[model samples]
Target: MYGDWSDAPRSLATLGYEPPIPGLIGSSQAMMEVYNLTRRVAGSNASVLLLGETGVGKEMIASAVHRLSQRAAGPFVKVNCGALSESLLESELFGHMRGAFTGAVSNRTGRFEAAHGGSIFLDEINSTSLHLQVKLLRVLQEREFERVGDTQTIRVDTRVVAASNRDLMDEVEAERFREDLYWRLNVVPIRIPPLRERREDIPELVAHFLNVYSETNERHVVHIQREAMEALQDHDWPGNVRELQNYVERAVVLAESDELTVDLLPPEIRSGTKRPPLGMSAQAFDLDTLTQEVVQQGLNEADPDAEDLHSRVVNRVEKELIAQVMQACSGVQTKAATRLGINRNTLHKKLKEYDLDS
Candidate 1:
């Protein structure tokens, strides 16, 4: 899993290589606070703990710290703690000498060693087991470790930067994490606000991702159409910058023209206000997702032995939909029926059948 993470090159912006996107933050007050904290802590070698929801750019912040620090000229290594199994992870982080384990074919360098003289980012660090956390704590305390199969202590200068979406202190309180290690890593804490909290930066982020992905994919897509940008800005961006980058890239690749339009955007973004309106083009009623979601929710909540399960589920969906359309059409039965692509008579019959008629 670690094989897939892209390292933020030291000179991302000034260099021609695609600037690594770590969800750039704009000037929102919450963002400014993060920006200020990052700047203040970047110059120090103290262990840093980045707190935020997933895809909120903790990695980017980590990269920013590495770049702004004295270690900018050295290698920057990254590891996703949640992505590896304990044995494999221990071996991966602390090099496993040949014959250390069955698959230990040869001696290899661990990420910390590779990051010597620079920084090593431990992403999703809260996933580590207490056993490993203790080892990590030891490293932070002594900056010394041995290979998996060897007892000889090897020392290296590596800056430890860690991130987690879950509250580590809560983990500590729950005994899922070691409090000592938490304090060690929490030397400097920085919280990155989710995309929704920094809505003002949406437009600029869209433009930045658009340019980067366009060049990366050699796509001619130039700009986001106004309506598309509006849609983007309206989204809560539950996935944060990573989601935004991926969404933009998808639109860019699919867009036939130079501009990204609402038509090219995902249903979530196209209908920013909520789910796409009931009736749309043959390609866009957007029923599949809505149906699945509602159906899954019903199944999950309903008793398995509930009588007439099929009829009950269908009736619930029909009732909810009719009520929704009726409300959308301001209780105008005819307009609601028209939008629903059904005859007014059938709409009324179903509405009455489901007790949704006024």
Candidate 2:
């Protein structure tokens, strides 16, 4: 799901100093490709659509493209489409004349006019209603729109950069989004991969955030222990880079020394544990035989000369089995009992008798 630097074009490594894309992290081949695509499409006037889950930094990439583009000198405006109601959103995008509605106290310029000769980033554009979508489609097609409660059409020149966490195509298929609007915004599609897909970049991102937070919070923290780093790398960051940035900031603020250690990490991270899939092992089919062999070894160590083989075997296997089930269930005794095909109280009694309660 991630591109290793090894997979990137070898020529890029040797290319004479071109300043790295500002504020956009791209150590992996996947991100480097995004950077390259951004540069390639920067000069064009075509609308761009950035697609990814939340916190994947679609806005940052959009900024990069604008910075490198001819519109670098123009203002960069942004609006969260999903954050406003349909009526308010229309006024926001297309402006409204005085007394356009109950709250329209004065004539207002829309985001389009504010972003003239610049760029307007419509984040979460997929959440717009069909009526709003029609208006957006008209703007994209004619580059002219009428202010609410005004018959005059105002012309504006601005590049549109729309982003969505949802797949616009899927939304269209479900009849929730307009296909024409989808095609209009998706003139140049860019998908930002989630953080978990780029684990190779975690160490660098951690270090970057560590320095940032340390300076901002006046912390002396300068290094992350290898164990702590391994835990960070192994985590599945559902919130992407934003989550990583926040976590590193939290650790830095909580740090008592110059280095981060596993002791300061969250329990899940420090444990680095997950449930093992059922019946998955090196020899899945031979589990019963292996279990018997391990039980026999434990029994011999407990009592080598015991004449009552059945009792000794039963006691040893039961204790070991209970302990293993408890561990695999993460100390949930009820689940352990279910896995063991026994009642919860029976498991509790066994735990007390064998002194494996912990």
Candidate 3:
């Protein structure tokens, strides 16, 4: 291991920086397409726009791009445009000179200058105000910025990678975002599909998260029960991979054995009934088979008689189906009900009866 250590200087170039590997683990066709695109775009200097829902790991793609670029030795700066107030966001992006504002006792370098010869990632770029959009457009067009209080223009060379969960085209139509800036940033667009659309990748994602959080938590959850894995794959993950990771970490901490079980899941997922994949045979229905099932056994001790049995069974089935639909729709009740072939009012009433609405 130390064979070449004594002969070479530890310069940035010699540090042997390999590109940061993405944590994504999936062989599904959808993910393979994204991986191919990522690899192809990594070598270029062009600005990239990553479009995806929250918790879909847009920043990871940005980092991969920076690491694979020729400017791998330079810094990678990330800014969350949605988290800061407008004034603070402006100051953060462009920096400020001494005595520029209340807390400006000294001059400071902005993210752009700090990331000189490297890349800057702007997350939630759609959340920025219109005024800030104009300033940002100027920076992208001129590659220069002035300090908050200084007239001197500072020129910096930095690659930009912007990400947003919202539809920029819709924003343009609504006049909430600048069309010119949208065109400028969307030079090369990459869309990340949501978890539901790529259900086949759920198993791989679940396994990867389990292994990752297990190591972090110092637990020995080496395997997941087949039933548990099936439940994970069938349930609609509204929060996508982030939610799955959280559940896995929770299971690791609460699990009594090395295997993950349905009991370890949150109530919604644990109680959810799995739906068959598309084109699968529809199971034969038997009233007697379902009649023996208990409805909220502990909570509702008043069992339904023959007269109310139909209503109860219909309600129970509807509740379970709606819960899964809501998960797939990311808790958007209107969308969920529509997908379930029911009105919002009917869905809301059932949600309350099932004690799931809250």
Candidate 4:
């Protein structure tokens, strides 16, 4: 599922005055291609659609585009379309007039108006409702829009940089997104590669985060052991760079010496743990070769008509899953709870119940 970047152009590196993309810290071939495309499209007025999984740094790429463009001196505004309701999102993108609705105490300037003469990054644009998408299309096509409850038209020279974790073409096919809007935003599409797709960059990312967290936490953790680095490279980072960053920060804070050893890393990474597929059935998981012996022993001991057998198996699986996620998060309850998709208090109760609190 991953592609090689060995054939990517090296002209920029050969004649480098400074790194082409300053804030992005990857030298992989895939990243180099992204950098090349970003720099190529920066001078134009076209809309840029960034596609990638969450945590792949779309916002960072958007920022780089703005900084490298003619709008470098102008303001850069951002909004998460998926983070707000349709009504609120409408008001957020286009300002609402005073007395427009309940709680509209005073006149407000929305993100579009605030981003005038510069760029506005719409993160998770796939989440916008069709009604909002119509308005967004108008803004993109005409470069003008009126505030909510206002008949007066306002025009601005703002660039649009939209991003989505989903395939917008699929959204359009499903009638969830407007076709015109999709084409309008897809003028210069750039796909940000996930961490697993660019494993070669892991060591660089680790070193960078180590330096950052070390300085922030005033720690002497400057070096990472070879085994630790290998584990980091081997593990599948589902959360991408953000996950790696969190682990590094945790390791730095817990470091007993200047070196980051295997003991300081999360258990899953140190042990090269691989997660089961998201869609794998419980029965299939129980049949895994690694657990077959245990399951068979339990089956041999338990009565065929035991009423608690199912619940017992469920509890055992849940306990082991929680334990692994806990170790992966370095025992941070909040992080573990988030990874497990449970509330913190609920996780605390489970931890105590499973005798994993210690």
Stretches of model 4 off by over 4 angstroms after superposition:
1-18, 276-358
Residue-by-residue lDDT tens digits, candidate 2, 1-358: 2334445676766783233476666578778778878887888999999999888889998898788799999989999999999999999999999998998999999998999999999999999999989989998999989999999999999999999987677678556799999998989999998887888889988888888899999997888999999999888777788878887888988899999888877786678774232232321234587578867787667665767877777787778778777776556666578778999898899999999986
**What are the C-alpha RMSDs, in order, of all predicted structures?**
14.8, 14.6, 12.4, 12.1
Error of 1 at 198 (Å): 0.4
Looking at model 3, which ten-residue stretch has the lowest summed lDDT?
277-286
lDDT by residue (tens digit), candidate 4, 27-133: 88898889889988989999999999878889999998999899999999999999999999999999999999998998988899999989999999999999999
lDDT of each: 0.82, 0.83, 0.78, 0.86
- Following a full C-alpha superposition, what root-mean-square deviation does model 1 have from the true structure? 14.8
Over the stretch 1-358, how does candidate 1's per-residue lDDT look in tens digits? 1132245556752453332224454666677677668877988999999999888889889999998799999989999999999988898898879998899999877887888999999999999998998889989999999889988898989999999997786677557889999999999999898888788988877878788888988888877789988888888777788888899989988988899999988886787654322222222335777688778877887898888879877877777677777765556666677788999899979987888865
Q: In each prediction, how many residue pairs overlap at the backbone (N, C-alpha, C within less than 3 A)?
A: 0, 0, 0, 0
How much does candidate 1 score in TM-score? 0.68
Clashes of 4: 0
TM per prediction: 0.68, 0.72, 0.70, 0.74
- Candidate 3, clashing residue pairs? none
What is the model-wide C-alpha lDDT for candidate 1?
Answer: 0.82
Against the hidden true structure, what lDDT does model 4 obtain? 0.86
Q: Give the TM-score of candidate 2.
A: 0.72
Error of 2 at 62 (Å): 1.1
Ranking by lDDT: 4, 2, 1, 3
lDDT of 4 at 104: 91
Q: Which segments of candidate 3 are over 4 A away from where they belong?
A: 1-22, 273-358
Q: State, as a TM-score between 0 and 1, how close model 4 is to the true structure.
A: 0.74
